[model samples]
Target chain A: MSGKLLQVVREDGQVEKALEPRLSDAQLKELYKHMLQVRLVDERGMLLQRQGRLGFYISAEGQEAVHVGAGYALEPEDWYYPHYRDPGVGMMRGVTIQEMFHQLYGNRADATHGKQMPNHYSWKDRNVVSVSSPLSTQIPQAVGTAYAMKYRGQRHVAMASFGDGSTSEGDFHVGLNFAAVWKLPCIFLCNNNQWAISVPLSKQTASESIAIKALAYGMEGVRVDGNDVLAVYRASKEAVDRARRGEGPTLIEAVTYRMSSHSSSDDATRYTPKEELEAWKRKDPILRFERYLRNKGVWDQAWADQLREQTNAQVAQAIQLAESQPKPKLGSIVDDVFAERTPQLEEQLADLQRTHPEVE
Target chain B: MSRELTVVQAVTDALRTEMRGDDSIILLGEDVGLNGGVFRATDGLQKEFGEARVIDTPLAEAGIIGTAIGMSLYGLKAVPEIQFLDFIYPAFDQIVNELAKFRYRSGGQYAPNVTIRAPYGGGIKGGHYHSQSTEAYFAHTAGLKVVVPSNPYDTKGLLIASIRDPDPVMFLEPKRIYRAMKGEVPEEAYTVPIGKAAVAKEGDDVTVVAYGSMLHVALQAAMKAEEQGVSAEVLDLRTLVPLDEDTFLQSVKKTGRLVVVHEAQRTAGFGAELVALAAEKAIEHIEAPMLRVTGLDTPFPYALENQYLPDVPRVLDAIQRTVSY
Candidate 1:
């Protein structure tokens, strides 16, 4: 593990010329647009939750670069096991705003069919595993998938994302140890947002850094400035390339902050210091990426304004479409419990349908 | 051809046969590779299939099951052994919440084709942590098929069926009878349909319902009851989740008396579900109150294991009581 944090763009958006990735102007603009879309959608989701139109909301307000940059570095063949705060990753991988909205509303059109809570998106066709609530559980699952890939002689890699708090879980240790021992093609990304429902990173770990913890597992560890999109993409691309070359797993710790409250139910004001929040807001991922794009002559005020309007309009249309959809049908309640419904479940469903004829 | 084999040997035969047929089948556990498992249920499998398909994983139950779920999601048949049913708690959340709910929670997008095999029940004098019948935990959770085989024939057939099932199945082997009981088993690959029960013995006075090692005790008790001039019918419930209610209900209807037996705790054991099923569906045909013969409501003890588990004498007593009632 290199003790230094990898940074391609400084806080003022000035690039470290030697480390800056050689991305085309169009790709640069695309990255900024992807991050901006996440911000706009998250804002609308929060407002909807506050207005009682949605049940709950969790925003990745300050960690856009971490998810989007890393997601952009992967190929479509790679499998992603995402945490809840990964809407930006899904967007980079072809998840439409309408699809996300449908999930948030838990409408019949939702891919998960109202089974999981809002923001828990899953696109099986895109090779994205469903988001589970339990912490660090996906770590071992990702390793297992990577193991299968290696056994089948497939070149594809498996990547799993989680927060700093998840690093403390037993699954985290078990997963890393197994991957290291087997030299599986996997990537462990820690989105160090620094807060897990009001618990700070200090309370979560006493180590020098989350990346350095990988040394114990005998895997390569890289720490990057997660607020810098260029830095995150570079680190993720290198790790993805290494994994594809059969060099085994890599642990990438993208350090950033969570600018929003934990969820719709949380009040960040109760624990977060006012000054600390202000400091992180100035170094916001979107603002930093906008400066970087402007420095490259790819971003202008008019384009930024137009993009915001277009994105917000898209979000509005998606929200309308999702809200107009009906809730999942009553019979669907027992539909996917197994490949085929058991006789007992069939009897229970019959009883329910018989009693609630009006609902059907 | 048919040959005499123990329950444990039948398990090995089933895994070896399945692995030979399907290259995608992966066998993984703590001591599965090179060690052939602590109980030798996977004996000679790693040598035949090689280490890539037969893996020895780290000593973490959650890791074993979680990884197996991942493998299944990626279109592989993953059979993970928990070593013992007592040590499955660490992976309980993964099994109950993740593996069981993957198909439903994904809205049918992803269904984990995983079959978790574990050795359960008492009588090995393993005591406490090594001996427990925790099938009720998995049986209570939907999306999982809980299967327990009492004999060699059922062990091989049911295991093959569980591996081929589209959904996750919990295959709990009774360690007590893993080697103690032997029966003729077909060497060819065959599947005994899941969600079905077998009538081990048929009689008229009372119906005795049991599974796993307890089924052996129930059969013995039925024999003793027959000698005592009391007719006892034994029903071996192979699968508890998708329980064969029709078979048991028919037996209760004919006998007019129900006695459920299990080696799990007395409170809320699978026997309770059987009793409730009889009461709800066959209440009119039942002549007396349904009785449950199960382990006492306490942690499995080290010194008093014989007293802790349901035995032939205890089952015979329950049958006599239910018959006379």
Candidate 2:
């Protein structure tokens, strides 16, 4: 096969060999269900942030299939560096919804304390490097991990996910070029949702595709229909296997759309039109996957009803856990600053204490 | 015996020693591999260690530092390079946010054992971007151990120590002094413990403190002031964060006068912080107002960077002001 850019597991529930990974009926049902669950989570998170019940957050509602499918394909040992917009990606990698809620609530039990605004989540032991606020910043980091994997003689694959907008950053080019030259075991996945902040994909780059940029860096570039969960998963899995085999890095552009604003801070209505939104709503990844499932006999109303209840209950339980978690302490800002506090930090810590002793 | 090598050669030696000592220690940055680094800091490191270890990464500052986080998290010692300390603005998020916060965020479950090396200070003809001493910015951040070495010996020692440190360190090497300076770094390997102050010279008069390239100027200023019978004690603060505040306080108690010096523009440089600290803790020990001799508050001039930097004459002039006060 040239490469498995899996788009549909089957046509009319019949096996489609060349188009996508020939998934067993069970896996197909799982992908569709996960995409729905994640999409709901993404929408609810955005709504909660807007209602002032939660802090600022980036929603991945429309990009669920891009990450869920790709994320589900990963091994637990593989490393991930998800961006702020990739809350769903982390979720698929087994980061609990409870931890995600604590992240938004800025609770003491939160992985990153309250230092980062809502959406920054990571666990080092999980091999998920903490995400940075800057765009394309994690690309080189994934490359670094891949280099280490090669050095240590491990088959570990290092993957990073970002949006199309990140490609404009110098870090993206530099990271790809370096990985390509070194043959590092990494898969650079770009969920090209078409807009970075407000800049559309057409304005972001003149390249034929973000993945094609990989060609210049001496890596394979595969463009896939990102809204199709199977396509994203198959492309990512193939790239991942190549990385594990020590062939080199691969750049995958999962062409998709963002159904919502960039974040709670943004207003998509300013740039995106209602008509376009309506058009995209019809092509929703969740809906498409659902239709696919129905054709495969896995979409009975009873199964859909039970899954919805289970997912909503799980999401609610996570939110309740996050709410019950204690708020992070003010002293946390001063701690972990360094192994030893610098004189300057000591002064600041002192100043904070003197002014806000009750915070303790 | 004192010998000579450029500041560049001194850094090379430091990296070479650290790399040889720890297999986990790896180098990454733009042009650091076959290009031997833009300044040749890793001139032959790639060939010596193989590309796997001495990585020449893409020209992505954020990526460079971010990758270091991954490398360190995975149990490797990472020394990510910024071609110049000034170019670090692009990676500010990584340095200030992630590299500094990892351990704290993880509640000590993780320590970002990484060193970010960059050439800093002024007087080189490379104009503003290449010559600015941007150490104070890192000094202001909480999680990073910021250090500036003035001599080859200290450079070798501190770089070794920083590489071994189980935290993120911003190792600011004064670019102007690279190769322009030389010292007999002990042939054998050893490390300088962080959070210690070096008393460059002993005196009872006002104590003058400096770091990085400014240490050279401060020492010269003290020498020139001696002609006027003013015995200025010079202290070099190799590490900015995890400061030797006790040593600084002790110096203030004895000298009864304090003057902190640095090449970063004055508003919020380490000098300002040092003066404030002295005021808070050792106000009674000061016979005169704690003074700060710093770079002018302006964009570091491209042509007359020599004029902008705190030079021997400028240091001596500040000493005159403090002594007269």
Candidate 3:
């Protein structure tokens, strides 16, 4: 729009693209397949909610490339603090479609043990921390983890992702500022989807760009086309590498869009215009990446058809498994409050059991 | 084996002892290292444990708490000091949303194992920001455990317990007794069980319940009432959430009168919640009335803090009112 916006390759759907660092034909296929899987998962999730299967859900549509691209750019040991709408990232990090669906359906088989609502998943041993519904709170926590990594003299990095709306919170700035000053290995990935719930970017912030905000904190800031998986991968790779090397934190704002209702409970048509939706629809992350991969000779109709069929069947099997699992135990209300339940909690638990005698 | 020490000094001793025993236990806060913290609760921890364990963080509340979470996730026992309880607002989101929900959201996959330490309650000349008792904020969160110690012994024991706890604990140290209340603590490693209320002076006529700095005032009021031949059971609620309702209900049933006291504002203070809870549980108990002795339903006044606090006179006054009503 102004002063030659950064681009990896000119977009015409037929233009040849250059090879990226560390991304071979196989890896690109891996990234694209995951992106496509995320898109279909998002579609099925929405349909499932409409059919009264899920209570509510956050969509990961239209931003698959940003999540997968960025996720693929990191090491397994690096800490990942994901926000609510992070199924794409989770899918890329070896979380099964079954585990994700099981968690969404509140099945006891859910990895979270049915503790959180849909889209909030975490593996304590996976180095990827569980995310809550609150926005921007993890920024400082991630920074703190990075500080500890530096303190422990480990070559690990700590990274957190949040929306553009999160940058307005005080903790977001405090975390980044502390990381920059202390030279902690923290990576802040800002998914600038242009909206936080109903508030648009115009009302949520007055800054020129979220990336620019990092400049004031003495951190490297990169703005990338979120639909371009190559660019997102490269930018995140360099930033994460610098963080792993202890050069301090870096902020990368992935310019993207929310292609669906904010959640199952939201109706975005009230605030978003048709033209705006169409404009963002044209930049669908999966299609753009598919175009790039096709020009690279790694994509064909046969592969596309196979991936679609396999993914649909896998998702269906996951849904059936998720639906078949039993609900969590209601008696667990008093468990884990302490190493052992206190007398007071025990009394309450007894009262609850008496009131609902059918449980336990 | 026993010696007299201020509440602040006992806390410092407990931290030093705990840190020396475990290498994973770390302390981080502004001025906690070089300046020895605002009240010196962590006076010599930095020098004793080295900078790696006793970290001096930047002047950022969010930074302090959020970073402690990271340390906790990394299998380190983290204790974050909020120089003053009133200064904890900036970090409320992190504590309530992240630290509190770590275990619940992760389905018990990850426990925060963090303790947020802050000095609360009135008596010194700290106007609004430093003197207010803000324990209710932490109590409302579903997964967090809140603890407030009334004296030097409880401070040391509860702090040691909080450090070993598997969940996030918002540990409130009474500012009023930081230097005033003196007591003898065990010279060995021990921890007071949280969620258990201590019966300071057991009786059957009336139940006067309070915690943190207000325990001293409540005890003093109970003594005066004892001289009047109306025995008052002073129950110090060491922990707020998962409240010791067993002790509270038992005391209320035996006494037939309930009077809750605290330095927090009256409208929806922890005292009010306790009164309602007790009423709902043991409503058949024939008490004179359920009364609450608390600060006025206003922010801690800058100049009139003394009049605003629920002191011995005010607590005694409330006890009289509950009995007469």
Candidate 4:
């Protein structure tokens, strides 16, 4: 399985020259910085949750390359229907750290007005649709956006990211089948983290690989080294190009591992073996990218250390700013249910206001 | 110019009218394009609008709805047909969780302007699977406007209105009367607002409230009660979510009695909400206990569907019971 995967940057700080993406040194550093920022956010988010400052937190710790690389392949005009673990996609699309913290705090400045849980990012201006809790629901939606683009004769593509667990959902099959038949401009990226909470890939599917499922739908499928940022980006860039060229959809299976617990609510030690976690940590995405950068003669220990300090300070400042904001107004609870509040919502709002006069 | 049309014909007319006016409107469903829909409600649409606009989708309800939500978010007004209301269960999660909550969940950033059309109710002997009026399921979910039309005129009007609505709407067509019911529908397009109720017949005794196929049943019951010297006011609650509570509540207040009817099961049906509304708002004006004429608390039967659905006699009986109480 490892031999069949696409690899540009090896774990030992070497790259297959032919497979390496032609990114400039500045672009490469930005990618590394974004991955580092994602790691820092996860670390601080977990600590905030543990310290009882945040209600809940979900992290994309070890799999930063999968999200950042795939998301970087998408243009700003394209739409992204992200899985819960793909906050890096939002960050790459210009969702500020402060905005993420506001969402985590469910403050008045939050885009969703605290309607959704923490880590469920939604930025309409950035063409990033809201993230839902249910798995694989965004697959068909991504295809649909592609359908709209194709119908309007536009070249924009829509990409949906999910985990290995989502491959079993009905929407996954339906979305792939529809996209294949219609030749819709869409991309389905399966972040095969090998674990869906407590359920392992063995129980999730008997298929040889998640990408191979694309063959049954008459579409292209590719397997990539998830920890290798260059490989993920190359694969995703090819798929995005094919979609933009109206060549239909492609399914990219990025093999990775969830090094952290499923979320703040779970303990991976209860099910995940310690040796397995240790093995995955050795192939950590950030470390491998660092090695690749160092081998390219564009990285140093002082730069890396300073980057960490700046990211941590930025995360701390965002937490403070987000925490100082007040919760959403009580009257806003009934708002946004529709374009305009109906009589029922108005009556309910009045009743709530009457009952809690002190809040207003 | 007004032409006499059946409910199904009016559905085709409404789709054609809307799609012709708005190029951004896309119709996707199983058999909607080449087959012109299983019921032919989309007859001749694909030929006229081309396959790009009238798409014949794969037989996946969730895919149809989920994709439609995506299309709506991307600036297209998507109208997806479920083929049958019973078959919509596969897409229930999409409807309830995704389509219904996109606006509120996104803090008004994304409003999925989609109209999901499904033929519902139990009078055509399609049995349990083909004939189940589950509008209550959608009406119970907030951020969704549920509309059911009883006649050809209202069908075209309400369907047009639902498509143009800013939020998602569940437009449940009464298949029982899709062809059985007919009326003079206007040639030009018109919109019968989503949250308003129509008084089919006015009277002074008891208010018989219904929508879709049951509206005709209530009308028949009212006519029968008229001969029996018991006046019954028939109210057509076309939209269940943004319920025209004012019309029904005012009628209940004036008539001093109420009788609700529907083809769905008795438990947790839309009738229960109507009964509760009347009891809570018009209890002081009521002269008799309100009653509901609804299907039994059981699955719509294959052998005894007539017994399962609330008919004219059943509605008249409930009207009589409420009036005499």
Candidate 5:
């Protein structure tokens, strides 16, 4: 168990193996840019919350590479069930920055029309299912989708991502057991951010690692360095390939840290010590990826600074567009309850209109 | 063209007919395959449809619902049953949060054609765990349809309709009348439209609204009311959500009196919703204030089961109070 966890990049910017020669320069740059873009998004969201411009925000922060890497590993046809903190994955799966801001601002342009809180993003075109707030509920649903895929004889697999705290949920157990029993084409990617709200991972489970628990369900479990982008991508690619080939599900536990409070409403300083937070800050995923690119002679300080400025500008413009949009109309509140509105709902909508007088 | 069948037999007959008519329809639950279900509701389905269509799932209710949600999303009519309604609590989160909201949350992109069948209500002496009137819970949840059938004929038609419906449905079969009640059910498949009420008996003095096993008790009370020269209108509200407010409203408007009955607890029961609807829609027309005959606000008791359930006397008392008022 001690030696099984996989790591490709060390903290000192040393690679155990040469991946650059095989990975095209464009793909490498794209992966690096995605990680940086997600980081920029997270940081700006926190600032927006501080300024009272946004109602709520939950940043992926130090865990951007894991999400970006896993997102890059799947095909567009595959179904993805993401946790609430996977805005990075949402962006990769065809959710434009403008659309994400629409969700963040909960404007009329938002697909849910502010029905869900901010960070709840879903795109049906890319097969990204809407995410629920309940812990680990996506696990079994993902397995079910995978089972359906198998039943229909489709070659595509289904992937679900979650936090370490989600592993303790009953849905997680049910999902793993059902997937294994039926040999469904599914992947369970657990981003072990080490903290669920205020509770640490140690208190969450007595088991040494979340990955090892997969063995009890008769499935393969792999622990990867979540901070290392290449390692996460490689592991996810292999699991996705295996699933497409009808090899059933694999549970991949990405070992990383959460460098921010749980959400805008939380204060991590109360529970997480300053020293621990400071120590993890040095292992920041963005910093490590920048170093890795520099060592490979593919990046420099000038290019890095220019890229950050361009990405920040792009994010700022999206926020501006999102903020300028008008609020949702009151009539839409009664809409989408079902495919077709019941007469009772139509009457309720009429009542709201009658009372408001100004809304259409 | 029709044969007399009990409620439990009608359930199996509907499953067999539907599975034959539609290849996408399947059944999954604990012991539903080889054991023919606890109440033999799915008897011989595994043999007729094979194990793939009639799956025997693990004893995880959440998994059953979760997998069914997936199957439905994948374009199959997935009907999973809980052996008893009481065991469905573990899967409540999946049903309400995931299955119920799939169509709405996805902004109508996907509708989970999943039907969860459970046997509920108390007259069988199964104690607290086996007997519970939990329809109100599902009925209260938005984007979900709730149906309960008292007689075998309605049970078959409603179950068939639920299987074909493009949304998630909670089909609660009254366990008490599973065998006690029998009616002529059609041999061929047919659908009873959801969200519509059936007039069990037409009268003009008082409107008595009930469903599932309580409908039988309501009928008895109405017959006794007839002996005293009082005409009672008995309405069977098969579908609680998308409720047929028109049928009951018209009846209450004609009679100028209303009495709602159910075996669920008093507070926030389906009965409360009916009474509230009456007061909201036809308050001015009603001659007497509406009354509800419901089970006490207590967990179903083991020893005093008869006392716990709302009986004919309770319904009669409610009728007398409404008629005399």
Candidate 6:
């Protein structure tokens, strides 16, 4: 299984000449910086949760390459339906570290008005639809968006990202089938992180690979090494191009591993083997990308250290800012239920205000 | 000018009218395009508007609904019909979680302009799978408005209104009377306001509340009660979510008695909500204990379908019970 994995950088820092020049030095550095920045934010989030500062956190630890690479490849007009683990994808699409922390803190400045759980973010301006907690539900939504795009004669595509566990959901099959049948300009990206919170891929399906499931829907399927940023970027870019060209959808399964617990609530050590974790640690996406950059002679120890210091400092400031924001108004809880607040909800809100006069 | 049309014809007329008026309005569902929908409610739409606007989708309710929500988010007004309301369970999660919560969850960032139409109710003997009166399931959802039009004239108006509404709506069509009954519908586009109940027949003694196909049953029951010297006021509740509490409450206050009727189960049905409303708000005005004529608390029976659904006699009996109490 490991032999089939694609690689742009070998363990000893050797690169493939053909793909090495595809990313300019500046672009490569930006990709590396984003991956490092998200990883740092994820670490700080976990630390904050441990200190009882934030309610919850879901880390994208070793899976940063998959989101960052694909996020950078997507056009600005493209729509993204992300899962909870893809905060880096949102960050790449212009969601600031401060906004991300604001949501995590469930503050008044958050877009959802402190309604949603941490890590479930949405941005209308960036075309990033909000992520629902249920798995694979967003797949059909992406299909619908792409269908509308094709109907409107637009060249933009919609990409829906999910975990390997989402394959078990019926929406995954239905969405892919509909997309294929209609030739929708959509891409289904399966982040095969092996563990769906304790359920392994072996139990998830009898099939060998999640990518191969696309064959049943009469679509192209590609399996990429999730840890290899260049491979993920190249595969996603091709699929995105094909979709925008009205060539229909493609399924890309990036096989990676979840190097952290499912969320702040879980203890992965109870279910995961220590040996497996140690092996995946050696193949960390950040280290592998740094090795490639070092081999390109565009990176140095001082630059990497400075990048870490800057991202950590930014994360600390964001945490402070999020904590200092005013509490969300109590009336906001009943607002946004509809375009205009119905009299029914207004009555309920009035009742709540009457009961809890101290808060207002 | 008005012409005679059946409920199905009114639905088609409304879709055609809305499609002609708004370019962004689209129709997507199973059998909606070439087949003209399972009940022909969308007949000739694909030919009139082309396949791009009227789409025949795969037989996946969840996908149809989820995609419709997405389309609405992207500025398309969608009317996706579930072939039958009985088979809406598979899409329940999408309707309740995604479509209903889009606006609230997004904090007004997204308001899905979608109208989900489904033919429902019993009387034609389609049995459990084809015949169901389950509007209560959707009416329970907060952000989703539920509409049921009893006649062809109201059907066109309500469908047009739901499509134009910025919020998502669950429009339940009465399958039993889809082609059975006919009424004069106006050619010009008109929207009957949602959250407003119609006074089908005004009387003094009792208020009989009903909607969809059961509105006819309530009328028949009211006529029979009139023959028996009990004048029953019949109320047609067009929308269940934004319920016309004022009309029903005023009628209950005027008549001093209430009888609710529906073709759904007895417990936790929309009828139960009406009874609770009268008890809570208009209790002092009520002279007798309120009663309801509803389907049996069981799966829509295949062999005894008539016995399962609330009928004219049952509604009359509920009125008699309330009048004599």
Model 2: per-residue Cα lDDT over A61-122, one tens digit each: 77888877777678888888787766665665567777777877888888777666777776
Q: Residue A237 of candidate 5: its Cα lDDT?
A: 89
RMSDs, each prediction? 1.0, 3.2, 2.6, 1.2, 2.0, 1.5
Per-prediction DockQ comes to 0.85, 0.51, 0.62, 0.87, 0.62, 0.80
Off by over 4 Å in 5: A1-3, A18-22, A300-306
CAPRI verdict on model 2?
A: medium
Model 4: per-residue Cα lDDT over B1-325, one tens digit each: 9999999999999999888889999999999999999999999999999999999998899999999999999999999999999999999999999999999888888899999999988878798898888888999999899999999999999999999999899999998888895799998889999999999999999888999989988999899999999988999999998999899899999999888898888889888999898888888998987788888888889999888888888888888788777
Candidate number that wins on DockQ, 1 or 3:
1
Report the Cα lDDT for candidate 1.
0.92
User: Which of the numbered candidates is closest to the native, going by highest lDDT?
Assistant: 1
Please write out the lDDT profile of model 4 over residues A134-252, one tens digit for every residue. Answer: 99999999999999999999999999999999999999999999999999899999999999999999999988888888889989999999999999999999999998898999999
Q: What is the lDDT of residue A263 in candidate 6?
A: 97
TM-score (0 to 1) of chain B, per candidate? 0.99, 0.96, 0.98, 0.99, 0.99, 0.98
**In model 4, how large is the Cα lDDT of residue A296?**
94
Q: Which pairs of residues have clashing backbones in candidate 1? A: none
lDDT of 1 by residue, B237-305 (tens): 998979998999999999999999999998888888888888899899999888999999999999999
Q: Candidate 2, B306: how far from true, in Å? A: 4.5
How displaced is residue A351 in candidate 4, in Å? Answer: 1.2
**Model 1, which residues run further than 4 Å from truth?**
none
Worst 10 residues of 3 chain B by lDDT: B101-110
| Model 4 chain A worst lDDT window (10 residues) | A1-10
The segments of candidate 6 whose C-alpha lies over 4 angstroms from its true place after superposition are: A1-3
TM-score of chain A of 6: 0.97
Model 3: residues with Cα > 4 Å off, grouped in runs: A1-6, A13-19, A333-360, B281-287, B321-325
**CA error at residue A332 for candidate 2, angstroms:** 1.9
Q: Considering summed lDDT, which 10 consecutive residues are worst modelled in model 4 chain B?
A: B316-325
At residue B310, give the lDDT of candidate 4.
86
Better of 4 and 6 by DockQ: 4
Error of 2 at A173 (Å): 1.8
